[model samples]
Target: MEHEPLPSESHAEVRIVAATPEVARRVAAVLRRCFASTEQRSYPAGREGGTRLHLTLDTARAAEPARSWLATSESTDQDRTHADEV
Candidate 1:
């Protein structure tokens, strides 16, 4: 598959610090869904016992979808938690 380069103006970066590899992987999965097209790198031994993940996304394509997906996820999570309490 061929990937088109994102314009410099459409690029955004994210940095995440996770305490364990499992946590880092989970964070990366969320980012992957948010930005269908992304480039990622890792900086281990970053701060104390955490690993830092650097992810770059094309904002023009990723921003709106990401926001909508996150909002939907948040609502679903809240609903699920509410159901569990009932």
Candidate 2:
């Protein structure tokens, strides 16, 4: 299927473009997370490896923090029960 990723051997290149180092790192992190077992590379290091290091516009989604217990119905019920018992 087109959705399938190419084999490691088939992947012979890496590219990066970003406004700063932080952006580049975030991009690399996301690529690594999404495409398991793929290497990310960097040009400036002049060293080659399975993992690539480069800059790119990040399109990765950030995980939102979990809501506090007080924000949920479970906590509300607990509070009501405690008030009734008092």
Candidate 3:
């Protein structure tokens, strides 16, 4: 089946498939720390009984540490580029 694309580049659909629900939720929790996200919806992944979780993230609305981290990363990349030219 064809899935519809996200409304914009700043929005993303995240899917976490893991061997257990706890693992899936753990991953989702980590993402939630960095981005604004919808509540996760959980489903059974396969006959063997893994978990599949879905959530929507708004990248444009980054959380505290992530915003700082991204800014620092950009600066670091620029510094590296300038250094390489020297």
Candidate 4:
């Protein structure tokens, strides 16, 4: 079946693959707290019996703290990389 195209906006599709459903759900829960998202869809994945979860997030609606945290984290990572090269 052909699914409808996602709306054209600041959004992201996230896929999480983990050894167990609990782990995938835990990660999804954290994302839900940070952004507005659709209900997650789950599927079986890999020969090792892992779980795959897919959800679409409206990044334009990201929580204030999450946006600041991501910006800070990116700068911190870049600083660490430059330090390592020095």
Tens-place lDDT per residue, model 3, 1-86, is 57676567878888888999999999999999999999899999889899999999987899988778766764434455344221
Clashes of 3: 0
Ranking by lDDT: 3, 4, 1, 2
Per-model TM values vs. the true structure: 0.55, 0.33, 0.71, 0.70
For candidate 2, the clash count comes to 8
Model 4: per-residue Cα lDDT over 1-86, one tens digit each: 56667666788888898999999999999999999999999999889999999999987788977878656764434455334221
Question: In model 1, where do residues sit more than 4 Å from their true spots?
Answer: 1-7, 45-47, 63-86
Q: Model 4 TM-score? A: 0.70
Ten-residue segment with the worst summed lDDT in candidate 4?
Answer: 77-86
Taking all chains together, the TM-score of candidate 3 against the true structure is 0.71
Please report, as a residue range, the 10-residue window in candidate 2 with the lowest summed lDDT: 58-67
- Put down candidate 2 lDDT per residue, 1-86, tens digits, no spaces: 24545334423233555555566678777655544324444544324323336332222222222123213425444455334221
Of the two candidates 1 and 3, the one with more favorable lDDT, higher being better, is 3
Q: 15, model 2: CA deviation in Å?
A: 0.8
- Which residue pairs does candidate 1 place in steric collision? none
Candidate 4 regions with alpha-carbon error over 4 angstroms? 1-7, 70-86
